[model samples]
Every structure is written in C-alpha cells, then in structure tokens.
Target: MSDNDVRQFTVGPDDDGIRLDRWFKRHLPDASFNVVSRWARTGQLRVDGARVQPGDRLAAGQTLRVPPPESAVVAAPKPKAERVPLSPDQIELAQEMVIHRDAQAIVLNKPPGLATQGGTKTHDHVDGLLDALQFDGESRPKLVHRLDKDTSGALLIARTSRAAAFFAKSFSGRTAKKVYWALVVGVPDITDGMVDLPLAKQPGTGGEKMHVDEEEGQPARSRYRVIERAGNRAAWVELQPFTGRTHQLRVHMAAIGHPIVGDGKYGGQAAFLTGGVSRKMHLHARRIQIDHPDGGKIDVTADLPPHFAESIKLMGFDLSLGNAMIEDGPPPVTRADLKAKAKAHAKSVRKERRGERRSRGSRD
Candidate 1:
C-alpha cells in the first residue's frame, strides 16, 4: 500500500473530550501538528467512519480513521559553493575540550553563548560542528543534555543512536546527576535546604519562564547550599536539581527571592548594570555524574567561565577556599537573626496576599 493509506483505531474511554489533533499527536510522535490538522480539515479524518473536524471532541468507543498524506521526505541541504570559514569567535566558542570520550558517549566543556542545537532561528550550533571535533567519523553528535545559551559548562553528547537512547533513559529514570553554580541576589534564610515547590507553565507569559504553582503543576525538587555571602547584595550558591525541567534552576532560584544575578529577565533590577558590578549572568553548569552504557560511572566537571570568575572575585570571594562553604558543618543561626527573618518573611507573605485579594476583588 502507498504511504497515504488510511489507518483505523478505536478510542478508549480515557480518550473522551480530547481534540482529534491532540489524540493524533499522542499516537504519532513524528508527525507535525500541521499535518494532523490538514488531514482533519480535508475530510481525510473520520469518526465512526464519517468526516470530522480537527477540533472535534473525541468520544469513547468511537471508530476513527485517518487517511494521512504521503510523508514528504526532504533531502538534506548541501553546503553552499562559497562556504565561509568559521570565524575566530565561532572557533573560540566551539573549541570544546573533551573531558571524557568513549564509543558510546562524549563529554565536553561547552563554552557560553553557543547553543546545543539549532532551532528555527538559530543556524550554527554545537551539533552542526560535531564533525570538526573528530567525534565518531561523520556521524553527527546528539545532545544528551542541554545548557542555556548564556550558561557554560559540562555538556554531554551521544556518539550513536543506541547511546542516545541509553542516555535519555538514564535522565528520565533520574540516574543522571547535574550540579550548577550561581550567584543569586541575596543570601537565603536557610543556609542549605531543598526547595520542593511544584512548577507549571503560566499562560501568556512568553519565553521559557515557569512559575511555582501549588495546584495543577508538575513536581519539581532542587537542593541548594550557600557557598558564600557578600555583604547584603549577592551570594554564591550551589544547586543540585533532582528533577529535569526547562529553566528549573532559574525559576526556582527566583521563587526563593534570590534570583540569579545577571539574569535580566528573572532577576529584574538585581541583574541590571549598576553600582559598578558587571552585567554578566554568573551561572555555570559546574559538574555532572552519570553511568555509562559501557559499564562504568563517569564524572565530568568544568572550570568557571571567565565572566563568572571575575564576578566572584569582584564580590570578594576567595577562590583559594574552593566552592564548598559549609564544609565544617553549617553554622548555627542566631536566635535574633532567626526572629528577624521570620518576621520579614511573614510581612512579605501578608503583603503578597493582600495584593492578590485586591486584584481578585477588582476582577469580581
């Protein structure tokens, strides 16, 4: 049969009220949403063997048939005739040193500003330049994990599809560990504690931003420790995320009132260029530990990028002391300090509640 042949399936009770397009999305992972919508709109999608719209609510026990269009296979693009060489900036950023490399996977120190992979707007990415690094012949490197565009540090790439599948399963099963270093706006009340706040995507708030939601959100957990405190302005912190979510570190840090310094979108005025402090985001992926598919555990670490190092120095942190600040056990919190912080937190909470109530009253 041709690729455009119709496929039929019966919906179960759990599939009720779901849009036809969404149902198809769950069933066909590789098919784009546009393709599914087109099939529904052209009367190629049927419910009980009758034509149905893309937005039609699915019913339990309904027989669905979808005559999908022939899959369009596009040949990979060939390099242009006059290909320009990689610029010095590109070379500087892309010249990652391999920390560990085996037949299954490769770990490297990914420099800041280079994206892990190309998107709709991005053209040059680490995945595109894998051949230059002499990774497994012409086979393109697949990203096992991702760092933000501005965040620099340890990055993992799989050399083969089987290795990629193994790494993906490891991450999903929480066997992979990732640690990050950040300079937040203020010292947290607790020197070390776990933030077990659940997070969810807020509507209309564009970009990769998330918010702490008490209800209807996914569970997110992050363990944090204060590395050092600098006056009343900023504190160096180490974070270990127990769950992998987009922008989890940034959002969680902001929720705790200590937004990561130089995070313009999340930190607000704290990240602004003022009072002689440089305006570079002082966040880095410090370390990662994961089990290899070939039988051994791998530990990889990256040195702080120059900007982060400079920020730490400017804040008067002693680099010789290393990143561990709570080594000899955490110091006790004074009774007076404890009382003062409790009062401040209570006041902030009350003020926030009052504002929320006023907004709700107005809406009503």
Candidate 2:
C-alpha cells in the first residue's frame, strides 16, 4: 500500500442514481465522505474525464478515476474472491450496482460491456447477480426487458412476482417509453425521421444479429433525431424504437446509411475514425419511462459511458442543446387500436410465463 496505484471503476446498472459521496462509501469503503469531498474539490475524482462534485449523480458505464486510499491497488484481484460459486466480491459487485430500488421494483443503470442475460460462454452477468439482488428473500427479482451487452442504460427489475407480471404486461403492451442515444459514423442528411423497415435475423451471424429483411421480417420501426453534428463527419443521435425487435436500432440506422459509431459488427473498422474516440460501442440506453405498479410513473435516465462521452466531447457535441432530448411525439394511434394490441400482447406474455412456471414446478 505504499506505491501509488490508480484504479478506474465503471459505473454499473445498480450504481445509477447514486451520489458520488455514496459511491465512494460503497466501493471505496475506506474513503470517508469528507475525504471524498476534498478529493472532488482538488479534482482527484473524475467521471468520464470531467471533474464532478461529490453530490453529482452517477450513471452506468461512466469511468470513475480515483487513487485508492492508503495507495492500495483497488483493482488488484481479490484473493480467492471467486472461489465459491457466489463469492463476496460477486455479491458486493451486485449490491453496489443498485441505481434505484423500491418495494415493488428496482432500476439499474447497467454499464456497457456487461451482459443482461447469461449465455454459453457468459457466466458473470446481471442474470447471475440475481442472488445478491434479492434484497427480499421471499421473491427473486425478474428482468423486465433486456439491453445489448455493449449497450449501457436504465434497466428495470421487478421486486415481486406481482410486480414482475405487471412489468411484463407494461412492456408487452407497448406502454413503456424507451429512449437511446448513439454516435453514428457519419451525419445523416435528414435530421429527424423514422425508419419503418422490417427486420429479421440474418443467417450465418450466429443468430446474434438482425437485418433489414422486408420479405420475411417482422415490423420494426424507429424514430431518430440528430441531436448534434460535427459537420459531415459524425453526429449524436436520439433513437426511439417502436417495436421490440433484436438489434432494431443498429440495423435501422445502418440501413439508412449511417451506422452507429463503434458498432464494428455492422459498420466494420469504419466505425472508428482514429484519434481519441475509443473503438468501444457508443450506444447507450439513455432513459425509460413506464407506469409504476403503485400508480404514477417511473422515469429514469442514465448518463453516457466514458467512451461515449469522450466521443461526444471530441465531436464538440453539446448535450444541453434544445434538441438534445425528444420527449413526446405523436401518439402511436387511437387508444382503441393500442388497447387491442396491448390486450393481445399481455395475454400472450402471461400465458408464456404461466407455462414456464408450470414446467418448472413439474420438474421440481
């Protein structure tokens, strides 16, 4: 603990909505809030390479640079931390990521590069962290929706079985407002537009990609508006997906001749233009608005990741512009039309959940 060791921490889903001082307490338990305040004043702590106050809120995936107390190596691998199936480090990691929590739900500012659900090769993921996320022992939290592994932002978790069912219905009913932010490779000619292209899984991509396949594809629509532009080079865009299709935003943008910055899978090496902008994907789940189970609404926002923020700064983009946020557009359609779709979708989701539960019960 003598030599200076710099440690960088990336904000995670659960860590969203947390104050900088509280963040230090959770992660750097040794650092007192008073010391953190001093550090912030002296510019010792930074989020996304920008100095911030200890009272500032943190979003998922933002880089937090700090020198661990006592010159300790904060990033040093915890000794045998992952020895057990679920280690203390794992549980701590899960506990530290809570952005918002209540009796019925939990909202996380999921950091980029973390998988929401586990896969064959993926082990340590949000899904795997459910054990620690079970703040209440009676009911295990449930995922309301999913975000791409490389995409960071506000993700919801249901705290109870009733809440989980309600959330499922809200999402399937299309009553939720999901917004995303991304940096595209080139500036689009049109500022505001909607892509009504049908999308389907492209063959030979390991079933992990979606393509604009009008012939045999499901309805996928997205409305995008250019927030800020750096001439004809790159621009910051706000995207709203109308249909919940896999890779809908990426494919829709790419199909329109403007691939998202750092999206190598779709845009290739051209995704990056060299220099300071990191090649990491620049897509983020900026915000989501949905009705709460206990009435009212739950609105959450997540800040850009360090890489995305760097890219934005590099492009001289100002997120405080008038067009930075696109709050309300025309309603999808008449209430009657939406009601029919909601009814059908909710019924299907409930049936599916019931089937899964019954199957599990039989197995047990």
Candidate 3:
C-alpha cells in the first residue's frame, strides 16, 4: 500500500518485441537474468496483472506489476566533505550551473565530453564528483539517466534509492519525455515522422569500433521533426526518443539517411568533420518532463549549449519557430522494411551463387 510496496510498469510502443529478461537486464543491471527468470516463474512478475514467462515477448502498452518481497531500502554511508579540483578539460566544458535540486533529485546542465559515469577508458566522470556538488547531508547522488559523453544537456541525479527506482521506472514506462536538439545532415522529405527501428549491438572486430545491427536488434523508436532546413545538405531537428537504447537516436537518424551532424561512427562520410559540418557532435538534450514523486509534473528545460545554439544560427534556423512548421507526414521506414530487404538480398545472392556453381560444373 506504500510507495515502496510494489511497482507497476506499462511498456511503451518502443519496448515492443524485446524479451522480458533482456528488458529487465537493461533497466536493472544489478539484477541477474536468473533472478528475473526465477521471479517470473514464481508469479512475482505479472503482465497486465497476470503472471507471464520470462521469455515472453513484451508488447507496447502492456502493464506489468512486479511485487518485490522486500521494501526499498537505502544504505546510509559516512559523510566526506571534500571539494575536488576540476581538470583543465572539465573546466573548459563547464558552461552552466546545477539547475534544480531537492532531497530526491538534482538537475545539472551537463557539458559535452564528460562521461556521466566512469568506465575502463574513462578516468574523470560526473559520478566521481557527486560528493563535491552541494547536496543535503551524507547521502550521495547517483545518475538516474545518462547522456552520451559527447552530448551536452540536462542530466538527472537521484539522491536516494527510492528516487532512483522511481525515475528509472518512469523512464522505462516512457512517462518521462526527453527532447533533444540535433543538427543533422540532409533534410528529410517529410518535416516530421516517427522512426520505429530496432537496434542490436554489433560485436567489435579486432580493435575497430562497434556498430548497431538493425537486422537483429532491439526495438528503438525516435520521433524527429525538422525544425529548419538549409537546402538539402543540413537541417536542425528536434529528436524525441520513446525508447532509450544505447545510441538509439543516433542510430535511428542514420538509418533514416540523416545521421547526427558530427557522429563519425554511423554517419560515415556524411557525418560532420567529413566536409558536412565543422563542429562537434551537434546534439543537445533540450528538455525533460516527468511526474514528480512528491506530486504534479516537473518540466525542466536546459538552455541550449553555446555550440548547439551557434550551430543553429549558422544553419539559419529560427529557434522561435516552435512546432508550427512540423507538418503531419508518413512515419519513417520501420525495421520490418529493413529486415525484409535484407532477406530478399540474401536470397538473390544465394541464387546467383547457385547459378555460378552450375556454370562451373558444365565447364568442368
């Protein structure tokens, strides 16, 4: 009956077709697949108020109620008051202030090139400096959501265990709306459309970079509207991602033939730095809307970073145009089309190889 009692989740359109266990793994990384599988088998995981198997394919708009055996708990830690000095790189990208803060959450105007959390390759990260950021008491802040290392925008931090769980649930359910502004190469034929594509992690080859496999990938959806177009070469766009796959927006845009301006990985030669545009990855998390735990809705807007704002200006986009210019249009190509095309291509190639074998046998 309390806030920590049981969590109910409604999958969104973007979450369709993914395995229940895989979905849970992405959302709750700490929880193992076997743990989720066991819970699903024991009636702990219910779909639309009914028990479902772990391998069950989750569809959009399906309500899942998960009753944890124990109430949410937070482990209190000793306080350490220390201000760490920022590196020269960190100081250079430090353009804005910590916007909103409460006992539960903190909103920061995160600058570009700063990883939200550290990994093997990363040394300095936003998570490492949480103690320095003025917060209440001894509770340390944890990242509720992350922005890519190259992307700049509003980043959310949860102060307590409950807040983190709540926000994570909201994001997974698609109740949390995220708006990103990106400068993309090439103007889309339609002003506005939804890109419903799937993305799968492509294993890295040798020491080369990795890629997303649209053929056998996770369902990822992004709704994008071209705000302003400078001929056919470039346009400023507003991207709204319904699903938060790794590089969802970037991959979706690239699939639609208009990669994010400075993305070298997916954009290939069309991505900026290859004569398309002279700028860093011109993407910015502009705003986010979510239902606050206390009550009411919290709509936080992060002012465009200098680079994003300047890029828009250079492209001759009027920021005041609003969504008025976004006309209704057909949705962007879906993953179904990509899969069908790949299948047909494979069939044709196989047929050609068979013909070659016949001709070689006749000559022999």
Candidate 3, position 103, lDDT: 72
Candidate 2, 204-290: lDDT as tens digits: 988888888889998788999988888888888899987799989988998998988889888877787776788788888888888
Top lDDT: which candidate number?
A: 2
Per-residue lDDT for 339 in model 2? 94
Tell me each candidate's TM-score: 0.65, 0.66, 0.64
Model-by-model lDDT, in order?
Answer: 0.75, 0.81, 0.74
Report each candidate's C-alpha RMSD, comma-separated, in the order given.
12.4, 21.0, 10.8
Greater-lDDT candidate between 2 and 3: 2
The best-first sequence of candidates by TM-score reads 2, 1, 3
Which candidate comes out best when scored by TM-score? 2
Q: What are the per-residue Cα lDDT tens digits for candidate 1 across 1-364?
A: 4535777789865455556776766676445667666666776668997888777767668999866435423244446565356676655545555677878778877767778888989987787666555544456666777888778888988776556656766787678887888888878999888887888887678646788888977878888898788877788888888887777888889888898888887778866545666577777888888888678887887788888888888889876654522222123357998999999999999999999999999999
Error of 2 at 8 (Å): 57
Cα lDDT of model 2 overall? 0.81
lDDT of 3 by residue, 1-364 (tens): 4547778888865355556876776565444666677778777788987888887867778988766535223234336666577665554443244777777777888878888888888977788777655445356676778998899888887776556666777877767888888888889998878888777776754423334566877767778888878888888888888777888888888888998988887887778734434568888888877777677876778887777777777767888864422222334467998999999999999999999999999999
Weakest 10 consecutive residues of candidate 2 by summed lDDT: 72-81
Clashing pairs in 2: 13-109, 13-110, 14-97, 14-98, 14-99, 15-97
RMSD of 2: 21.0
